[model samples]
Target: MDHRFVGTAELVETPSVAVVVDVMRAFTVAAWVFARGAEKIVLAGSLDEALAWKACRPDWMTLKDGPPAPGFDLVNSPGLLRSADLGGRTVVQKTTAGTVGALAVKEASLVLCAAFVVAEATAEALRTCESDSVTFVVTGEHGQAEEDLACAQYIARRSTEPETDAAEFLRRAARSRAATELEQGLRQGSHPDDGALCVELDRFPFAMVASLEGPLMVLRPCPTPSSTGAART
Candidate 1:
């Protein structure tokens, strides 16, 4: 399969499959939320869109950028999701990079949100899809973030080599500029544990595949394919 990595979302074009990587936060938070049993997550391009979605469906949770909203059940933080009860609940989310990148590539035959948490599963899912080509999109904050690029490269490696070293990839990501910034933020008392959560690889075993449903980008989990076929009797 042909694979290409784009540094930012703006340059993304139609491909058989597009994987959006935002390991510093965004998609990593999504993975944890799903792991906590979130029924579904809707991706919005902006804070206004996320709030609007909340207005339309008052029962759904809405997460925005910046600090956590007073009445909101969750925010854009993986550390917060670690303690939230998301069972049987749906969430609407808007972030600076991840979701925006996913929404930007509506033309992709398949769209998958990727982070270290689901890296291996995402690779397996892409292999199962058998697409002729795949594109890994690094949805950095404003420009390119080293952490996102690292995660994308890790995913690309795994898509072809099932035995790729996740630990080595994460170790490298932790040394990136984005990770350093996050670590500094933690030291300054901003969600102290979030930095560690962001780099935790393979925390979840499912891939989060997205689909455009009306005005929302809906994400759902898919189990990884088994490595071996059934034996002949």
Candidate 2:
């Protein structure tokens, strides 16, 4: 399979498969939410859309970044997701990068949201997919979001070689601007453990695949083709 890496939501084109990555938080948070048993996540294009969805579906939960929006159930923080009782609940999510990137890929036969947390599982799923080409949509602008770029590269590499070393990619992510901001947030007692949660490679053994359900882009977890062993801390 041919693996292509593109950046931001704007440059995405129709590919057989597209892996939208946002390692700083969005997709990583989604992975954790699913791990906590969220039934599915509906991707909203903006805060207004997410809020509108919430207004109609009072039983559904909403997650977004930054200050808590009115009626939002949680911030886009994996730490918060860990403690939330999302068992079988539906989630409506809006983010600066991840969700937008994912929702932008309208023509791909398969769309998968990824981050370091589910990198190995995503790659394993790609190996079994019957697509001739794969595209890694780096939600961060081209060459701008270092962590997302690193995660995309890592996913591509791991797809071809299961045992590829990830230390260097992890190092790059740790030293990125996003990581610095996350560390600052940690010191401020806001989303303190999220940084740690986002970097736990291969933490989940399933791929987060997006499918358009009516007017919404809903993400659901599909188990990987094979177990990639225990997650790395």
Candidate 3:
């Protein structure tokens, strides 16, 4: 796979298919949900939207979690998911960084939800695609960070020719403004519960793939490396 790791908004302009990463929390949790057994998933940009969707279709089933900023029900919580009954239902989720970044990349023909837990699965999945080029998009912590960069580079190292280390890429993308915003987010102490929930590996067979058509939260068991399959939570 010919892949490039791009660490900023500049990636929006890049023509290659982009894998939007929210590894520290968001996408990780989505992967976890798949492991549990969800039929489909949706990535919402706002709490209101997810909740409203849930209200309109109660039986459809939804996982409503996002930044507990304001007008939000709960932050992303993995512990909560473990106990809840998804029953192959659909989830509408938002988060501090994950969903928003995901929404931005939804325009891509193939937007695969990604994180550290499924790093190898994700990397290997992308390597099999027909796209001549792929890009790892770290939407960043707040907007840029070492962690998301590291996660993206993780894929870059495995599937592409990486020109930079995780830290360097983070430094290049972590602007003073973005860093301050990211720091303020840490101080808010708003979504602690959600962080712990999204870190499980191969937790979900669902890939949480998104697109202009909408999010396709495909659910299944862990892909047999021999089968080489991947889908969204």
Mind giving the per-residue lDDT tens digits that candidate 3 earns over 5-110? 6654665474447777876556766766666666556776666777777788775554444334543333455545555566667666666676776666656666
Better of 1 and 2 by lDDT: 2
Off by over 4 Å in 1: 9-12, 141-143, 186-190, 227-233
Q: What are the models' TM-scores?
A: 0.90, 0.92, 0.69
Model 1 global lDDT (CA atoms, 0 to 1): 0.79
lDDT per residue as tens, model 2, 98-163: 888888785679999999988888888888887788888888755368899899989888888888
Q: Is candidate 1 or candidate 3 better by TM-score?
A: 1
Query: Weakest 10 consecutive residues, lDDT, candidate 3?
Result: 213-222
* Candidate 3 displacement at residue 231 in angstroms: 13
For candidate 1, the clash count comes to 0
| Most accurate candidate by TM-score | 2
* Model 3: how far residue 90 lies from native, Å: 0.8
RMSD of each: 4.7, 2.4, 5.8
Off by over 4 Å in 2: 9-12, 186-190, 228-233
Residue 29 lDDT, candidate 3, scale 0-100: 61
Q: Output the lDDT of residue 98, model 3.
A: 69
